[model samples]
Target: MRRIIILLLLLVIALGSAGAVWAHGVKITYTVTFSPTIAIEAAYDTGEPMANAQVIVYAPDDPKTPWLTGECDDDGRFSFSPDPSKPGTWEIQVRQAGHGEWLKIPLDEEMMQSGQGVVTEGGDEGFSTAQIVLMSACVIWGFVGTALFFQSRRPPAQEPGEAA
Candidate 1:
């Protein structure tokens, strides 16, 4: 019985840890630096180097300005030279192929000059509604199965006529 209790507690902890990981959103970190030239570094949510991710920079004054563009390398990094003559607030946008959401980052002159940009995917750290419902159902079914399994494994009751 004690072993069963310990096992149950361990199982609960393991499941909770797994759920936490699933609930956490993805993160991307990069830097926007100016050396009279523009430089950037980007990484994917998985932390694995991402190559070919699209990155676009737009000057705040004129969104239509021929924006600078670059693609992340195998190490998930990219750098480009922005028109130094045009210095103003800039918007950085990144998108991975097949990913529906575009990460929009705003950088002021100070930030651009200092070179810092950090963006995280999925703002919230929690399961979606559908996922929550499915997980609840799974837990309930697991408990019901455990109970039935124990019941089935129990020894049969002894008859009154049987010797002690």
Candidate 2:
């Protein structure tokens, strides 16, 4: 019974860690045309496009509700013109499969006047150092706990010359 539980615990840990190694980071880039249109391009870090991904755009004035929602082209590209009345930071999010990223483009009055702005990516974008440390610690802790559990169930060693 004890052996069965220990094996199951180890199996669970193996399966958990296996899935963590199979992920690819997502990347997105954007360009604001002189026409005041924002074009977005989404792709995996491996260079494969996030073809036909879902897109949600939020205007500067209203951040909660989506200002506009659409889908990317086969090339993982989408574009839309911002509202001239709403001049602040425009947020665009692109998602496909299980990957997604947020792009924050601050379009203030000056940028609007110049017809362009510096686009930046935002959000807790990727795993932080703390997060990686915590995950490694958790896996090590599980292995240690499993070892302790396994060791506790071992029978005591007998002397070679002792009678049975």
Candidate 3:
């Protein structure tokens, strides 16, 4: 009887562990390499991407005069490296036929001195370890309790009824 109970407990633990492992769904990782540059994505108030829009960039030293001029791609995304010689705040003016916006891009002194790529990591957004453990323990306890209840309710061994 003791051995049977131990075996049952072991089986429950194994099944519970398997369930916990299966609950951890697929995991994906994304890495992006970034340089000291300004990236802008123009969009309308309705969340529509504004493509082929004129993008005029002005250096920090000379704000009134335009330094660089170009247009955004089809995805309304544009990127440009600031003038390292003039390390400060840059002014970017994005204009279309009817809509226009001004953006300020800042370049620190460290980035100007050492132009090194920076790596940013996006981790897996999933349940914490403690939560997973707690859930697994609850499932195992419930299964064990149910099994014990049914076992206790079984009819005991008895010969043919001779009296009430």
Candidate 4:
């Protein structure tokens, strides 16, 4: 019948047009990677990591001379172990290309007896859990809002018997 043929043609056209609508949108994937960080970091007063620094150590007896000399790694960390035999006070001096810092460590009876080295520096990890959750919520809301807006703008469907 003519009505059946017309209906099939309209259905084909509608499906073809719907395909065009689907083809109009774009799918873009953005991947973000957060790598794990190394430990033992030195920082300035502003909390910026100090990289490639010169590290020097001085014994309590020798105040004017350096006992040990080394350079900090890329992570701004200069690992060193003090002498257990020299039980007094030890000074550590860290200097970059220009900036510098000095820390005086006391090797008292209790500390020397314990034989445990203290950790003076540490690195700051990435974003907190709350921050990640907030960002994910924002992105989800943006996607949902965009989908709703597009859905509202779509053309209403035509009934089988509706006039053109």
Candidate 5:
């Protein structure tokens, strides 16, 4: 019975690790256009082939209705045109089988003002290089602190003949 329990635990651990790798391995890219037309393009992170993944474009202000929907190609690419006549910010929601989560990409005003892309209100826009750098630094510091915490928890090795 103990052997069976150990085997089951090992199998669970292996499967969990595999699932984590698969989830992090796949990357979704979203390119949204707000001007000339409201459209979106998507591709995989590794540039791997993709097919049949659903791409939904919605009004960020109103998630109840999606303006456009389409399936990705075998090349891991998908496109959607949401009523060109309607203007403003938009949000993209992407989903693929085995991905297990929805990927959300925002099209903000700065991207639209660039004269080639669409923009959505309240979406990320005009992020300066300094802001990016600061955010990156914060993330790095957070990871460093977490690592230090675990390292400190490890028990110190006792010297020979040391008291128990």
Candidate 6:
């Protein structure tokens, strides 16, 4: 009985600790419009928008300091006009509720002037939604399977007065 109780407690603790990680899966993607402004959209792997999340832009010229900092709008979208004087890869970071994602966009003098809209992917290259869900389920099933295996190997609980 004590062993079973301990196993159950371990399972609960593991699941509780993993809950935060499972909740924080932010992905960021960007698109350059015809106006030279770069637009970004942040969302969870589950396709849910990261509403009102914090955004920080870092110019390539000054990588250490943030060029601009702001929060995403209600739709998880933010746009900023990059400094044409600084020609290189611009970095953007989006963070919210313990989840953060980074994106890098390379813009040279010619590329910025072209004004050709192109959708680009960025941020953590993670598994798809289905893959994530499947992996999580596998982990949970592992715990349950181990617990059941141990429980099965144990003999039935006997009353205190029963003979050995």
Best by lDDT: 6
Give the range where candidate 3 is weakest over 10 consecutive residues by summed lDDT: 23-32
How do these models rank on lDDT, best leading? 6, 2, 3, 1, 4, 5
Q: Could you give me the TM-score of model 1 versus the true structure?
A: 0.46
Clashing pairs in 2: none
> Tens digits of per-residue lDDT for model 3 on 1-164?
46548977787677666633443132222232335566777765434556888889999899999999999888677777666788787777777885767766556566665766554334233456577667867987787788778767865434377456
Minimal lDDT window, size 10, model 5: 118-127
- Give the candidates in order of TM-score, highest first: 6, 2, 3, 1, 4, 5
lDDT of 5 by residue, 1-164 (tens): 35445755775575445422322234454555445343333334333445666777676567768767777666656655544443455566667765522455544455545556433322222234466456655875676567667756864454577776
Clashes of each: 1, 0, 0, 0, 7, 0
RMSD per prediction, one decimal?
Answer: 10.2, 7.2, 15.0, 18.2, 10.4, 5.9
Clashing pairs in 6: none
lDDT of 5: 0.52
Q: What ranges in model 6 sit over 4 Å off?
A: 1-22, 117-125, 134-164
Query: lDDT of each structure?
Result: 0.55, 0.76, 0.66, 0.54, 0.52, 0.80
TM-score of each predicted structure versus truth: 0.46, 0.57, 0.49, 0.44, 0.43, 0.63
Candidate 4 lDDT (Cα, 0 to 1): 0.54
Could you give candidate 1's per-residue lDDT for residues 1-164 as a string of tens digits? 55556767877676666543442223455444445344444544334445677777786677765377767777656666655555665556655764412334454555445444443122212355468657876986788588768856865455476676
Candidate 4 deviant stretches above 4 angstroms: 1-40, 116-164
Poorest 10 consecutive residues by lDDT, candidate 4: 25-34
Q: Which stretches of candidate 5 lie above 4 Å from their native place? A: 1-41, 98-156, 159-164
lDDT string, candidate 6, 1-164, tens digits: 58767877886787557544545578787877545788999988667889999999999989889999999998899999897767799999999988878899988877676755554445555676567656877987887788778867866675576786
> Model 5 TM-score?
0.43
Instruction: Give the total clashing residue pairs for model 2.
Output: 0
Worst 10 residues of 1 by lDDT: 117-126
